[model samples]
Every structure is written in structure tokens, then in C-alpha cells.
Target: MAQNGTAESGATEERPALPLPRPVTVQEIRHTKVSERSTGARLCSCSSSVSSVRLQLCSFYKFGIKCQFRQKSKARTNTWCSPQMFIDNEWRTSSRGRTFPTFNPATGVKICDVQEADKEDVDQAVAAARAAQQRGSPWRGMDSSSRGRLLHRLADLLERDRLLLATLETLDTGKPFLQSFFVDLEGSIKTLRYYAGWADKIHGKSMPIDESFMCITKHEPVGVCGAIIPWNFPLLMFMWKIAPALSCGNTVVIKPAEQTPLTALHVGSLIKEAEFPPGVVNIVPGFGSTAGAAIASHKDIDKVAFTGSTEVGQLITEAAAKSNLKRVTLELGGKNPCIVFADCDLQMAVEEIQKGAFYNQGQCCTAASRVFVEETIYEEFVHRSIENAKKIVIGDPLDPQTSHGPQIDRQQFDKIMDLIESGKKEGARLEYGGRAVGEKSLFIQPTIFSSVKDHMRIASEEIFGPVQCIFSFKSQKEAIERANNSQYGLVSAVFTASMDRALSVSAALETGTVWINCYNALHTQTPFGGYKMSGNGRELGEYALAEYSEVKTVTIKLSETI
Candidate 1:
């Protein structure tokens, strides 16, 4: 864990501008000089504080990449991370020869022009993916062990380019540099390696049967996978979908969110450097209505995995259903609850819950938007939470000292502010920060509301911002009831010292994952998904391999003489 004390040091450096392929109105990519910050959220004192809030994960879970995480790494001194689409192992402009501007949310400045992929581009990508995974294709004929090595190579490439990817992540999405470096990039590397190890291990099994016949169950790839990743964690989600899908010998057509495509596009360059076979992994960056909808409705695409809003998930599912009934897996929005009991560690709960609430500027689907605390400790929890919220230094994502960064874009900023205003109108007391912070950027203060009612929009709706609502509960039953009242069932936590209360409450909660005394502590080994409206299918661990695999049963007739 990292220490909370703030500090300042010496000089800093920036990556020189890389030449663009084409001319367009581009803002000077601004990278400010600042003190060298420890690549950890200054919230703990553990030895491996860089791993963010995964409390028990001290190191990178023994993946042996510890040495790669150096003290300070600047963006690579190289060419610009191109915006061209990666299909058939080559970078090219869209079919329509059009481009769109992606901005740095922190400064509200245009970063660069990206090729805008539409339905035509999606068709090209899906076609490439389909051809790559066909019966006689090189990708399909490659041995599983070789595929695993390729994935490991991809992981190594990502590790080597960590600084570049992290910088691009921060520049595009407006997440803190430290977070982009230690949390997102580290997680992406770890996930790739994890799935890499699973590549050869995914196999078929022969089972006992009647004497006259033999039965075999073979696990085969689901063919071309259509992935539509969310913007909040671009690098992580990019790896999340591709790691497992590719590990299981499936080709992918990924549509990265339009808001934060820089890092994914950068990863595409790394994929080329890693020497992946053509069309094994393709990234198309565009809006949901075009690229995303195309991925969902493309009949040639065998499966579609999405991580975004519940509404979008439904649309994708409907499209998939209408077109050849493609298999769909969604990791959608959540209004997760953090239930704090009287017997819990107040300070720890306050800090952890607030971290979950405000991390990624509260744009995460699993944001701890609702908090139900026992009345005995509600006031104290709110007080400490507000104090901690004040400690979040919101500023330019490039600044090392800054902890919280801006929201994704102006639309998200306005949505969050509008929700905060709705909280005020609905009679919830604004206990702390509740408005936009910086004038030019998309940064919003970590807002907290107290005396929240269950029916209020702030409590029921997925705010997807740094807005937290705290409500009081009289007893364990009331707390459980209130926490389970939302349409989302992604994740929830029970804060308590009593094992009995913790176990009972966690079991009773209508959530896919329930933590005891922690919030948003996810691991690569954990199978993460949701129930009810939060969507279906797991994203990590052994279970995720199932999402990209299909079962084939073969029966062989034995000779009668036998």
C-alpha cells in the first residue's frame, strides 16, 4: 500500500512529437513537467503499492515482470501512435477514407485524427478474421503451444512498450498517469500472460462410454469473435477480450470505443511488432452505431463480447439475435453498493469505498455509487469519506502529482453534473464536492451526497461518475434490502469484522461478486461478470476460456469383435 502524504521532487521530460501521416488541425500535445511520482496511488504503504487497491496482491502475482516496472518511465521516443485501422496485420485508412479527431479529455484539446471505421471497415475486419480462422488457414493450423508463445510474445511487447501505452492511455482517457502506468498497463500485461499460459492448456477430453463406442468431447474455437470494448479501461479491456479469445485459437474483430482509441491503436502497432499472424487480432476504432453495430449484426462473426452500458448491451444482443443468433457476452454497467456495518473498520471502509467511487473519475461500470451504512456509523463514514475525497488532486492526466483526472468527454461531464444537480433537486444533501472542477477540461470534483433515498435518481440510476450517495440503514436486513434494490447486480461489498454477518450478507446479496471489507479489488484469476441487468458471461480466469470455446462431441463405433 502507498502512503497518503503528498510530495514534490525535481525535473521531468516529455516525448517529442511524432510526425503525423496526414495534415489536420492538431493541438500541440501538451505534456507538463512535474516531480517524479511513485507509480502507486498514495493510499497505502505496502511494498507493491503500484498494483493499485488489489489489497493482497503485493507483486504482479509472480508473473516475473517485476523488474520491468521501473521507477519512472516516460513515453517512448518514437513515431506517433498511428490512428490507422489494423486489419490483416497491416495498418490502413478506412474504406471510406474518412477520419475523426480524438481529443485529450484533460485539456479538451484535439490529440490527433483517427481513421473513422464504419460498416464497410467492419466488414473488411470481419472478413479478415473469418478467413484467418478458417479450416486450412495458418492461424487454425498452428500448434497450441506455438499460439501460446505468440501470446507471450505479445505480452512481452506490451511490457517493453509500457511507457508508451500508459502515456497514450492517460493522454486519451484523462486517467492519472500513475494509474495508467501501474494499474491499467500492469493489469493488461498480467492478463495477457495469464491467458497465454492457458493457451496450450485448453484442450479436449475423452470420456468413458459403452464398450461398443467411444465418446470424445472437443473444445473448439468459436471462430471470429466480435469485441466491442468500453472506454474507461481501454488497454485493460482490449487485452481482456483478445487475450482469452485469441488464447482459445479464435480470431477477433475489436471495435474500441471512439472516445479513447489511442491506446488500442498503439497496441495494434505492438501486435504488428510481435509478429502475430494476419487477421489474428484487428482493431477498428469508431462510434457504436457504426463499428459496434456492425460487429454485433455481422452474420459472419460467430460471437460478440461487449462491455458498456446496459442499453447498449441490449441493442447489441438484439442485433446478434437478429443476425444468425451469434453468441453474445456482455459486461455492462453497475450501480454497485458498499455496505458498511457498525462492527467494521471505519477508516478502511471509508477509504476503500471512496477509492472505488472516484477511481477512473467514477466512470467505471462498477463504481461504488451507492453506500448503505449502519445508522450508528453513517455520520462518521460520510465525514471521513468527504475528507478523503478532498485529497484527490484533479488536474492534467500527465501531471504525476495529480491523482484523479478528467471524465472521458464533455458529454459525460455534463451527464455527471446533471445527475449531481438532480441529487440536489431530489432532496439529497450535498455533503461535499458536486460540480465541475477545472474550467477547460472535463474534470469534476469527487462529489458526495448524504441522506439519500432509494427512489432518488442518484441512488437508482448508474451515475458513472465521481458522485457517491450515502444512505443510512437501521439493521442488517434493511441494509441488505436497500443495497439489493438496484437494477444492476454487478458487484457489492459487506464491510464488517464479524465473519457471520459478512458471510450471511454476502450470500444474500443479489450480486455476481461480493467482497468482505473491500471494494473493486479484482484479480486476473477471478471470474468477473454480473447477474440480472448487469449482463452475463465471465471475463477472466478459467471461465472466460469457455466464452470463446465451443463443445464438439464425437462418437466412434468400436468393432463388434472387441
Candidate 2:
């Protein structure tokens, strides 16, 4: 059994307060500096009881030399970093001259003012993409190797400015700095590099025919791609869609979610630095109703690739069909399942469950929101899970020590709270953590609900919050049935000592990706998409390259037989 305070005992110790040489104001602290003493200088000693004297001495050192200091000024609240949208070959805003305020959920403070693109912007972006697809455009006749070089260069630039990108992502989306830096940014670089390596390698096989005939096949770019990315992994998902699509010789009209558009706009600058031909890559940041709808249904767009909610995915599908019957790839919502067996490692299981549920505040579509534990270890697993949840440090994302941060915005925070209340009203036991934590932030406690039925809303529907619902299962058969009972089939996980049981249970789960003894693991080399209502087509890997290309067969008759 795990000890109750095992996790809390390892809490990071607070740093000791240091007394400065002088009494300096808060403004001076911002610009304070230090210098090394000369070799012959004698050390000055002070008694611990003389606290004020020590402070004065520190201030004397600070002011004695030419040192940098900060001046106390009015708090610059309500500050924003406004970045313009990139359309065609130009940086422009909506024709209607409208904008939306994007807030930082950590402080409920406005981080930036984003342009709210309307129909005019979307149409112009699509037209530019179409123009780029024409014969005379730079992208039209570009060789695969050259395209690969451009993408590789872009990856290099991203790596160089990773810290800046990480800060921007943290400020805009409220994700932890380390998470955004290591996970999101690293994944994006790997994704771009992976696709870059594939650029020159993609080829179509020739079909064998009778000796009297000659036949050949080719894969050509789809042209004029419309990419709609969600806010959760804003820059990462954008790279996932655009890197492969553009590397495969397609022009893109990308529409980033309005709430977190900074990183995508920053990417536009990177694209320019990469020297990608104008119109080959365009971005329009705005509301889903105007910019998103316009791009999805645009007659000129040859294909549409989207990552977001199932409801919105359905709407995009309908719009595509109604307008131009555009080729569509949708990576939508998921209510993923994670099964824990009695013989599994309890410690590792608890850790994976914590990461699966609380990473990104459970906004990820592949997060393990539901857990089905074997009856033999149900109570113990539940207890350990609650203990682990309490140890999760939730606070400002800017703090490097913070493990989890607030949800994307006020609306998402309120929706998650409502679902938690519903789970209580619907008779699920609130095991732990069912409230917000900070006053200035929208942080929600990592919540767990026990005794949840398979049909309950908390178990069946996609809550998309840090809520874990646990169900007990008596047998493998029952576990498989319960896991397969969801309308979503995006991802599933199983933990067991027996390899046979792990493989057996994974095989029976209806999800597209099944993890054994793990949860929410991803790679750029792997294909990711869901079965059933989880949406269609795969992103990443070679399959994603195929998504942007059309296969064509050519045939010829020989003049004479061999």
C-alpha cells in the first residue's frame, strides 16, 4: 500500500529570504545588478540580529556603483500583444475593421487584441491559395527536395526561437511553460522534421500490365488546402496540418482559433523568413462563424483538414458537402478509456492517470478521462488516485514549479464546473477535488468521481476537463463491453501484468490507438485518428502526406509486342 503523505513529503522547499546590502524600492529591484569584489577587498561580516543594518548595507552596495535599477510605475494591466493576420502576400486585418480581445486565463487579463476576420478575409486567403496553385506560382513546379529544404529551415528557426515561442504560448493559452516548451514545441519540431524527411521520399508505384501495354502512376498535390486548427495545441496542431500539406506541394489557407492566435501569427513571420513563396501559406485569425465557415465552404478550396469538437466537425462536414464537396479530414472529440488491472504497477498507473487526466487540464481529446479498474484493486486504486490528485500544484503557468494551470478561458472553466455539478446531481460520488483553487486564475482542482456507472454523463460524454470517472469491473468481458460502450473511439489504454490480457483487452477496444501500460503517448512517426464518431482520416506519418495528394494512373498502348 502507498503511504498517505508519500507525495507531499517530497514537496519543493521554499528558498530562504536574502537581505540585500541596501534598502531599495520595488522599482529598483527590476534593474538591480551585482559585481565581483576586487582581489584585495576585505569581506564584511554582520550579525544575524542586525536585520535592518544588513538591508541598509545591501542598499549601499546597490546604489554605490553604476547599477541597473527598476523605477516604480503604474501597473501595466490590460496590456495586449496584437499581431496582424497574414493573408495573400500581405499582413492585413478584416475588411470590416473588427477585433476580439484574447485573455490570459491565469490572471483573467487581456493578453492581446486579435483581428476578427470576416468573409472578405477568408475569400481573399482562399483566392491567394488558388492563385498559388496555378502553373506560374512558385509552389507549382517546385521539386520535392527544394520543398523539404524549406520545411527543414523552418524547423531550425523554430528551435532557435523556442523560448520566445514557449513564452508566447504560455501567455496566450495559459499552459505551463515547461509543458509548452518541451512537449508542444518539441513535438512541433519533430513533426516538421519528420514531414520534411518524407517530402522527397514520396512516390507512386507503377502498376504492372500486359506486355503490350505501358502503365504509370503518380501522386500530385491536392492544391488549395483549408486548415482549421483548434486552440488547445494551437501551434502544434497547426504544424501537424500545415507542415505535411505544404511539404507535399499544396498551398494552405489556415484559420487559427481566435483565443490563441499569437503563435500562429508568429509562425507567419517565420514563414516569411523561410522565404516560402507568397500565397503558398496564408493565415487568417478570427471567429469560427465567419473565417472558419468561409474557409470550409469556399468553392476554391480543394480540401479541408480540421481538429476540434465533434459538433463543429459535423458542421464543417455539412458545409463542405453543401458547397463544393471538398475533400475533408477531421480529427474530432474523444471520450478515451484507461483500464487498470489488479496485477498492474499501482505507482506507475497512478502517475499515468494523473498525467492523462490533468495534463493540459484534460483539454486533450486523447486524455484518459475514464478509468475501469479490476474489482480486486478498485478501492486501493481509487485511494491512490485521490492522493496523487491532491499533490498536483495548480497556479500561474509562468511559474516553472506549477504542474497544472487554468483552463483556456472563463467559458471553459464554467462549463467544466457545470459538468462536475451534474455528475454529483446524477449520483456519482465526488471522490476528490471539485472546486476552483486560485482567486485571480480559473484553475480547477483535479477532480475524481467514484462509483460512476458506464451510462452516466460523466462517463459517457466528453467533459474535456480534469475529471476522472472510475468504474469497477468484475471480469475482462465486462471491462471490454464497458470500454466499447462509448460513442467515441479515439484512444484507449490498458495496464496489466499479463501480456495476453493486455493485448486481448486492447484488441477489443474500439479506439484507433491503444496503449498498453501507458496513456496519451504520441509520436510524429505514428498515424493518429479515431474510429466511429471520433472523426475521419489520420494526421502525422506518411498517411498524412497522402491526405494532401491525389493518386493518378496513366496508361499507354505499346506499338509492338516484345
State candidate 1's TM-score.
0.86
What 10-residue stretch in candidate 2 is worst by lDDT?
35-44
Point out where model 1 deviates above 4 Å: 1-82
Model 2: per-residue Cα lDDT over 1-562, one tens digit each = 2254334567655557864222111322121122112110101122222111101112122212122222344422221234567875456666888878777777776654666788898888888888888996788888899999999999998997686677668877888888888888999999989988988998888778999888888989998999999999999999999999988899999999988887887787677657688788899999899899998889989999999999999999999999999999999999988889999998899889779988898899988888999999999999999998888888878777787888998888888999999999999999999998866568899999999987677888898889999989999898898888888999999998899999888889999899998877898988999999999999988888889999989899989985
TM-score of each candidate structure, all chains considered together = 0.86, 0.86
Error of 2 at 349 (Å): 1.3
Best by lDDT: 1
Q: Write the per-residue lDDT of candidate 1 for residues 2-28, one digit (tens) a residue.
A: 233323343344447864221111212
- Models, CA RMSD each: 11.8, 12.2
Stretches of model 2 off by over 4 angstroms after superposition: 1-81
For candidate 2, the lDDT comes to 0.81
The local lDDT score (0 to 100) that residue 328 gets in candidate 1 is: 96
